[model samples]
Target chain A: MHRRIVSLWFPRLASDRILRINPVEAPFAVTHHEKNMERLYCLNSQAVQQGLVQGMGLSDARALCPDLRTGPANLHADHHFLSALLRWADRYCPWVGFDGNDSLLLDVTGSTHLLGGEEEMLEDIHQRLTHSRLHVRSGLAGTRGAAWAISRYSKGIVPQDKLKIALSPLPVAALRLDDATCTALQRLGLRTIGELMAMPRATISRRFSLDVVRRMDQALGDQSEQIEPEAPKISYAARITFPDPIGLYGDVIAGLERLLNRICNKLKRQESGARALRLICQRVDQAAVQAELRLARPMREAECILPLFERSVRELDAGYGIDQLRLEAFDVEPLPLVQVDANTAHQDSGDALDDLITRLGSRIGLDNIIRFLPAESHVPERAFVEASAAYTSPESKWPRNQGSQRPLRLFSPEPINATSRIPPRKFCWRRMHFSLVKATGPERIAPEWWLDDPSWRSGVRDYWHIETKQGRRLWMFYTPRHPAWFVQGEFA
Target chain B: MAELEQFFPLEIGRAHEVCGAGASAFAAMACGADRSDNARTILWLQLDWQSDIVNPVGMTPFCDPSRIILARAKNQQMLLSCAEEALRSGAVSHVITELYRPLDLTAGRRLQLAAEMGKATGILIVSEGMGSNAAQTRWQCSPECPTSVSDGHNPKTAGLTVLHWELIKNKKGTLGSWKVCWNAQAHRIIVVSEACQ
Candidate 1:
């Protein structure tokens, strides 16, 4: 089947979203600050009409149009708007992707005629977008390259038979070449697509970059170019519709339990388990309440999931009864089959740990649970890194007997007021006074210069493990840079 | 969430609940309880806005800080329910929770039952507030001054820390106080000062 691709260009997508929210009739442009200079990123139609162009300095634009309004360039908001438009465009075709910065590519090959032929589809899209106050230009062709070139430079649909004839008159820049290459072609007098095409292929490749020749060939349809369309995510969802709405919590739980069983069985058959699950309680009034659970490890067992669901299910207000219950299992992964060895103690313990993680994860979140892995560093705090307990395993045993001794717990560095003595006979911390019974040498630990730790801003430190008269074994550090002492850690 | 009832039959059970005095005291007890061999893994669940102040580095005195699973719930309801779930799983060795306020008697009973059913221990760290609950034990812990003798490395003694703990309520035993220190060499909580009634 012949492919039918549609390309839509949003010349002022970034500026347009802002203009849409606050309608502006005067000339306006989006400016991006780069290298200490504000440059015009994108311009609206009014700004373009006033002779302002993209990449022109903001100062020059303002000089040209005294009443020109400008806003900071928001690429994020533009991309977000494009994604929203992408969902809306799903009405046209399921396969739609944003091409480059300000364009959308749709593969409507076999789907266009369903919405009353190509012309009707284009007209519908144009009218809907125009109704929404979006300035859009669209082109439909047999190939992505042809469609893209036509959308930006020409108008309407270009049929397969006339693809080459229609592109012949356009400038060489229509091939999306860089300005240097376009200028080189212009200097060589090969200004139009027809002129570039008439030249020898080997000569064109030798004169310009391979990309230049490749793009020209792609535009002319000599070589096929594919458009990457966004793939819709597959949702593993199961729902039970009730003929009569059930009001009781038990009835809702029953329906949910039934739906869960079906989905879990399906997941088990697929050899997969869901890390995240969502229960959508569809009320009789059409309002839906959702309860979600996240697991540390992927789980498919009904025994493991249902009990957790029960608590969340009770939280949902059925409100005027519930007509349906839908359950979705997302973030699915293959649950590997483990060989049940005779050494069941070790295996069972591992499984038990995983189970504990999942249950705890469903409640507290997996990120908060962490495992410490020994890091190769002399700095006391940098000696270890936190890894998610559910995900990472320690690679090697912790380096024992590293410095004089690593403390059991490191505090967030509390400063201590101490006597300015070589051994500092007494010290005060947390409003409590401790007379030093005995003192150890300053174990000099230089700060890791590569790291910018806020606490380490004082430079190198002389750490001293001191025993206070209060019977406390304290790990304190004396920074020579600022000549101050800090009570950093407490043994246990 | 899709329920997978066809996979395994749902079991009904609850967990054991115990309350601790404060954050530091709770941390000490949790560290001590976790030292027991029964726990397969430890879950440290903190309620909303309660980022764990327990330095993992300092946790070297208790157990492998890496082995402790930390979970932060967004609210009190989530914190309670999550704690209950962790206890009921029967998978973890211990469940430690930090809450802004204590659970009521009913919720405490539910947690206790869950822990019993799961064969796991649950420790609830109540900050500032207290409630009448069905916990097996209620403990109050406070930091005690350290007393140590030097080992000739320097004139200073380096490795001794102590906490004074009061067993405020005991379901089976008499309420008492004791001074304990973490012995890093043995990785155990040794009672330095014997229990005083």
Candidate 2:
């Protein structure tokens, strides 16, 4: 396959990333604070129109235009947004990589033909990017270095044979050299790349840095340069664009079934199962509705997934008509077939349990569903912790009642009014007085000092398993320092 | 034993309502009726009643509190729809819903049909009044003794909570009223006295 590399440079990425999230029409600049001084890190078109240059001190930039608005530069968010753009560019080619922090490199050698000729492919990219309101400069060449320089220096594609001529008019900065190197070359009267190339190779290597010669050689294709493509993502998506706008709910369900079947087929081929599936219905009016189903176990069967959507399908409001339907599965796991005899009617109860989990998870929310897991702690509240069933599993069997019995029901500590802490012969709780019929010794428990628990701020607790005369088994605790008694739990 | 089985058993694929002021007591009883040896997940659909959480320790004797899921709906319509959706989900073996007011026949029928379709049991715990609907059985329960003294051998143990219930409507059998108690040792409901025929 012929190497057809395309490079896209995002000049206003820092500011564009911010504006894309928060769109404001006023003149704004992303500022950076350095050494107790603030300076402009990036400027939008509005700021640029007001003759504001980047790297200028904040005070000076404000002087140029008194109404200048400033925002703190977020390099992290900018890099994240650029990575998303790189993934978006995968539609054009599989081999896509970040050129720098703000640019992308795509190897569309065999892929460009899929979208008509190379010229039409570039036009498609340009048009779509412009539609998204992102300002981009692009170039295509035979080498990564040439493509990088052409994108920053010149416009459009450069033929492999005409690489030297195309790069000659560009300045030394086009080779992506450091500022000090560019200035040193400029002082030596090597202003244009053409002048640098005319000089003897040995002379250029000795006077300027070896990097200058290497960058020139790489750009001219004398030495090959390779790009590190972005890591390929495992995508499980099945999409269908309608021939005509479908308005009916039945029609939408039909579309969903088709997509779901496709996804299940794909998953079956890979010997994997999906834990979560998302359905996106794009309407004719441009409003899209999404319905997501989370599974308790990895599932690949269409019958299992289709019914889960049945309850949530009504919420998918196909405003006007849904013209496109897409189903994407996430968190896929290997689901090897479990060997079982045909005659044995032992259907995996796991499947039934999973169905229950999925149904309850979707309706009541997966977070609300909980499972009790024995935590490695001695404290009563910390002895067992409730975990979201969708995420965690019970690791250990609950410790049995050996010497002492624990309450079946526990509540957040409620203060009890008791006759001055003498094992509470009588206590007033919830506006009702209870006489202690039987009492167990104080089970002293110390707080985990290493961990800061607001509830355990009282230091140590002496717990008692007491039965009230009213037939209520009460688990009460007394604090030594506070000399107070409180009811923490009750037996069933 | 035969009479206890006949007492408003929470049959799968059927819709039942436990009405009157003591809805929570009957609701807890319905949850205890889950017959699966392996505990099935439970979803509590909260509509009008705000506080339905049992004493955490108290739940241990009845059902695994860890398997309980709590969901709150905005209005009566949403609550009914949510209940219908939960019944149709077939996710849980049983769904215990709290209804502040009686549902109309249409809404109740929809819920019943959904329960049948999903192959799960629906237990509606309604507060006060008896609005007629399509449920297979309607029960009226109230706390009777709350702490009735069992055989005085274990006086230290808190007294058993006794409930009086009347099977006001039973589509499959004759109506009856009986007294039942929470057997702390068995973690289940046991009929203490004979039913009044």
Candidate 3:
């Protein structure tokens, strides 16, 4: 079947609504109300038939019709609304392009097969637009320019070779020519395309202009016109509409398995893996929910992504049963196939650890599960640290140690008041009697005054590595002369 | 504006100043660091008391002062559980702890020697009444005014946590008690919120 193309146009569309407030069947013509007003003001033709006319100041138009609603144009909103139609048009055809502010050109080449046939496709697209509460004019033709002209002039299809006859009755303006060219052609009594086509091209150019001939040549396909169509921003989308809307956990689980497989298949075929997935659910009353799942690593596996969705489905607001499901993957990148062990098919040990962490993380949250990384610090108390399970590994080492003997345990030094200078005989702490046994010298380690380190607030430390009578080895230190002993740490 | 959660409000406690030789090494542990100087390390230590502990749950959270009594001075101290805990909290800016008996000879030398090599802040909570010679500060708390009464709620206590706290001995600050709020969920002292009594 030959593909059909359609172009739409709205002439006096703004004029019919602006100066003359007749919303429909309003015959109007719009000229510049202000000198610099670009495309502003429309003439009310229906109102003109009822004694309303253009160049009659807007105030007079309002005086002629008391209920006439007058308003300025919103050019930006118009463009935005038109762009939205451009996106919605994607559902019908792959090659929908913007024609103008009030028009859309659909290349319904292969798309007619989807909606049954050519007339049906037009009716379907028309019905969709009508349901959206918009007024539109459509025309189909074998040529782009002919379709545009016929849509505005005749509101029907202009078959191939019938272009000259179809565009004949329309005004010279239907040629989409500039005002100067149209006025020039009108002055020469060459007011129609057919009239102009029959005459010598040299005479038309020689009398009026040369650029009109170029436009005229291109419209007739004598010269090739290349259109730089914008392709959709290459997104990843997979969707499934359910025959029966199911709400059970088992049903959603089975559906998710199939859905994830399909999505992963698409990503794999595209040579990419999904970094993020959005699950969209359509339900009762046209209400819908879109749940997004983010991955720490880009992934493409039914085993990997499905389980994540299963747990995540509980968080989705299904609201009156989901009838349609869609999954879109984004932030995709090429993934290498994981070549694995053939000798022991069960020996994928690298993933075992990550799986355990992923499960634990899914429960208490990934942030709460952490592992310690050793730190490089000379301070005994600052030698170790913990990192979240997601960003770091459990067995990573922090560069520390390489100094003096660090106590496995460092305590707040409790002072033992010396009753005598001969390093006390016995002191009671926690009501437990610790008798002094084998003693060591007072290692008078002064605070490093040059560095101004704060932990050394006391003048100096006379540390003693002593052993208690109970055989519990102790490391005590004293600030002697102004003599007071402190229990700092223990030796294993 | 944010009302700090009745628990840890994403605000990890930070050490004001770290010293000893290896102070810089342990400096990274300050709750979070100023963005400009980002190299920081925090070591959190959780010491489960085997009893004989006064305010075992670090009332001042992390501060300690000491002097040697004549008898225990000849020998030293060892803190088994606390040292293990500090090595655990890698992101804790301050090495805060509480101990039943002051760290003796072996313990003090180990910690001082440890601080000398790295930048770490160790705040040990020592009982106010027990006078030892090793700790830097002996923190003690006496009951202040009875907790206020509101409607049917008891003024002296709220839920299971103690609310009113007073600072007894601080080696670096003006020697007096400052009020401390408490959180039961986090089991830590909440810093004061009001201007003054």
Candidate 4:
């Protein structure tokens, strides 16, 4: 049974063309991106002939060949281009995935028959990408890693099992050990995969690392090597265009309505609600700026989203004008289909209504809005946390003991200015004076000693509930370390 | 839990007599505290934006109480997002946005009525100078808690909070300035007792 696998390696893809630009014919190397002002990852036999040697930096490379052209790598663009090739490669094999960052791997088991044979299928994939200005190497073997090693190390028309032999002579770098590991291996004088294979099992296991053994097993098909494909992100967005670019900020509001309607319609179909919205304004000079809105609830409705865009109009840079308007639902949460009773649903709860929230969320980033989360701790300060507008589901209770009314705000522990060491009569704190009338609690809260965190360096805290003659109730605390008293909270 | 939400009815006394001519500032004041002391107790909530935050309502349904608490941010769009967060906290009387510049009168009226009907208080926290334009009461405030004090050796950091509020304008007799100690952990503020001092 033939397995049709296609592999493409764009080693000199960057340098091959620079040779044509200025005609620096002899040994000039093509360099990848620059690390700094000087160095370049040189592609040399092609480079050295043109006075471009192995150790030259980009500036040095450029100086080596005065008229040499340089190209910056575009990884995202490359991925897009790679995806397009994958689409085209479907004619040869059904399973195709990327390998080693710059190569494509395909499994053509049971597919080669349609393409005439293994050779023809390989030829077909190679011809297609090459026709589209991409270079590839074809290798066929029983295993994925073996094929990979053969493609990287072996010569043209590598027959089956030729790789098992060829791989032995190839450097350990072919096993994909990172630079540091490969350099370490080279320093250890175990340069080739053959040397690594020859090393004692105990020594390689104890000295080198597990990765070396894992790579060997994968190459020999003793272990499975799986390629994780990137999952396509869930994106919900729609756009509209006008005959003439709309310049007025008010004009965009109407368009936003249309886009919002479309977004809501799509979300409704999916039984989902949007937590965030991004308004992309495509302007002149190919410029685009996105205005976003975050919702506190999983919401879907034009009324909820429209008013938000109304507020955002003031922030938009309505340059030469917006030729295209796009509204994308950025963060999404599954909207559980709700059975809205006609009575409660239709009953107008208030004159202002809930539209204000949607309006506001879409205007600012979703995260900017936050709600308080009740935490598990009783340390007044640790009792609650600030939550994002859409991260949680609604709960029924404040989730706390209903004994005392909590102050609407809590201050970090502050010094309590008092005349005496004990709970004093009156004290000055921050230019103000106060006297305590009622008091409770010296609840000693010790820092958890198990987890040593620096912030808890002050050993323990003793809390007190104190009321002042002026009718202000306070949750004051005294640190035992220096025996200092300070006010921390006030009862509402 | 539902009882707690209703515990604070988004309502103030006087049987729904709306405050001054439907301004955002007026509506916020009309829904002010109803204590007999005539001191409209106010809570100043400050937040830090450094980490991941959960949705308030999701954590507790009480946060979605009827009170409409509007929030003001650096920009108009930011107002909505902030209000949604306040709404989830369960105790805001109404959400009122005080913008840097005056908006259309209809929008202000819409905001005021929306705030009142929800039994929530709407607050327009405009720039200190801007609120003066439409506010029934303008407050010139200093920290209620003194942060630190000067020690004989170094300027010792004062740990207590003390805020002084002066009512620059009001429909009733001018309320004298007040000095209150803030207790953050308990989320309460206390009126300092001069006699104890």
Best model number under DockQ: 1
After the best TM-score superposition of candidate 4, give how far the Cα of residue A187 lies from its true spot, in angstroms.
Answer: 17
Candidate 1 - CAPRI tier? acceptable
Off by over 4 Å in 4: A13-39, A42-93, A109-128, A139-244, A248-274, A298-307, A326-358, A362-365, A394-408, A435-443, A448-459, B1-111, B116-197
* lDDT for each residue of candidate 1 in A98-137, tens digit (9 for 90 to 100): 7998899998989987899999999999999888888899
lDDT, model 2, position A217: 91
Model 4 lDDT per residue over A1-492, tens place: 433344556555444434434555455454455555544443535455576654467776776677655455445655666665556556666677777555667776677779787777667766775665444676676567777777777634444455457678988887867899899889999999989889887888788789889988877667777654444445699999888888887789889888888889889988999877889999975899778776656678788567655666668888888899988888898997877686775333321233433444454444444545456655555665655534543233455434343443355566765524467778766566677665666677787677575645777877777766554556677776776777765443
Greater-DockQ candidate between 1 and 2: 1
Question: lDDT of all the models against the reference?
Answer: 0.73, 0.77, 0.52, 0.55
Off by over 4 Å in 3: A1-5, A9-97, A106-135, A179-190, A198-210, A226-235, A238-255, A280-290, A307-326, A330-492, B1-197
DockQ list for all candidates: 0.28, 0.20, 0.02, 0.08
Worst 10 residues of 2 chain B by lDDT: B48-57
- DockQ winner between candidates 2 and 3: 2
Ranking by TM-score: 2, 1, 4, 3
Ranking by DockQ: 1, 2, 4, 3
TM-score of chain B of each: 0.76, 0.84, 0.38, 0.43
Tens digit per residue, CA lDDT, model 4, B55-174: 222212112211222222455534433543433322334444434444443544444444444444445544444433323344444432222212232222233434444445544344
